[model samples]
Target: MACQSSLALGLLLLVSCVSWSSATDYTVGDSSGWATSVDYTTWTSGKTFNTGDTLTFNYGSGAHTVDEVSSSDYSSCSASNALSSDSSGTTKTTLKTSGTHYFICGIASHCSNGMKLSVTVAAAASPSTPSSPTTPSTSPGTTTPSTSPPATTTPTATTPSGSMSIGSVRDLAVIGLGGLMGFVLGVF
Candidate 1:
């Protein structure tokens, strides 16, 4: 019975870790919101976009329209061939692929006036996995130590879209604690 419980506990821990991965939601133009006056190019320059991440455009009602367009349409500032359009004052687009995405304001000359955005989406990051330590040779009567360099990760830059949530972190903590408790109980 104890062995069965221990196996179950370990399985739960592995599942919990796998399910903790999440994507981020970014608001375009930051606190300024999405507007013609905002420099879309500069706004997106320093940001890292990835597949599964969402891009939200917020604007005043009837002030602007968000249009997903092809590269040529975006460059030419033409909405005639827009792939999709939204004008409810807010628009959300999920980046589903690894490539370039172009958005423009189709309100008259907004695009020409610089109300355009282009983003290069990278592939979603793979789930992290535990790595084995490196073992070095040691002489007899001496203890050999295993060591490894810490893994380096590139931080993602995020813009505030108001109201932050730590739900994922909280969930992860709860899952981890439950797994630990289960393991302890099974062992003893």
Candidate 2:
């Protein structure tokens, strides 16, 4: 019974750790909300957007329209061929791919008045697997020496988008705890 309980706890921990990686929801225009005269560029500056993240546009109903458009259309402030348009005052768009995404207000003269947003989305970072250490081997009668220097790895920093990041220290700790629990369950 104790073994079963420990196994269950371990499984729960693993599941929770897996669930920690989730998409982020960014509210456009922040406290100012989505409207004209707001510097969308400034709002996007210093913010890191990743694929699977969502952009929520909040505005007064019927006053403005959230229109997703191509780069050319966005440059011209034209929504005649919008990829998607929403006038519900609460537009939610999930970034499905990594690249530049353009948005603008469909209302007349609103986009030209700086009500447009263009954000570059980066691909979501994949969880890195821990690698096993390699052991150097030598022949029984001969010695082999490596000519090249040992390979080194450089770790890149990733900015977390709201939810817990994959492969983060917390994630590693949870994984380690789960593994320990599993080992204890096996022993019992």
Candidate 3:
């Protein structure tokens, strides 16, 4: 009976342990934000926040704090601290959900001094599937016009009306208007 009880407990614990893997592995300010979490405002390759991924801040300094700021794209910080400046900030917080998350260092107005960062969680795709772009039919039910000089069809030219072609009338009218305007200006 004891052996069966032990086996059942082991199975239960194993099942619980294998429930699910963490979707996010955010780090504190890396020496630089290259492919990882950066301080201030940026992310690298490994720091990519994806859909359904919750980011947890890690501090490296004792004087650092994650300040949630107001943002239009993503949600603000979840919490802040006056002593989270450890290069590996410990007073960390998790991003509520996958979206734009803007945070800054909140220490004696450190943010106003330009200590901030932003993260955008883009939608994730399945590894076994490919995503395709949606395209709308823009053609007006017509085919592309051939570019061979429009087939070089011989176009018979048409003559203008009133015995005056456009070229002569355009020039004559311009000269006549100029003369009339000059005469009026002189009289004035």
Ten residues in sequence with the least summed lDDT for candidate 1: 156-165
Residue 110 lDDT, candidate 3, scale 0-100:
53
Q: Which candidate is the best by lDDT?
A: 2
In model 3, what lDDT does residue 40 have? 44
Misplaced by over 4 Å in model 3 are 1-18, 31-42, 51-62, 72-89, 112-114, 123-188
Residue 19, candidate 1: alpha-carbon lDDT: 68
How many clashing residue pairs are found in candidate 3?
22
**Considering lDDT, which of the candidate structures 1 and 3 is the better prediction for this target?**
1
lDDT of 2 at 100: 97
lDDT of 2 by residue, 1-188 (tens): 87778777777876676666457799999988899968999999998888889999999999999999999999999999999999998999999999999999999999999999999999766656555557678879987875555565646565556644455757586767867766985786
Q: TM-score of the candidate numbered 2? A: 0.77
Q: Write the per-residue lDDT of candidate 3 for residues 1-188, one digit (tens) a residue.
A: 65556555655654454443435566545444212223445344445565555445554465666655557312333334322233354544555456676666655545555556777776544234333443444588866643333223333324434554334445555665566556545655
TM-score of candidate 3 versus the correct structure, residues matched by position: 0.40
* Candidate 2, backbone clash total: 0
Clashes of each: 0, 0, 22
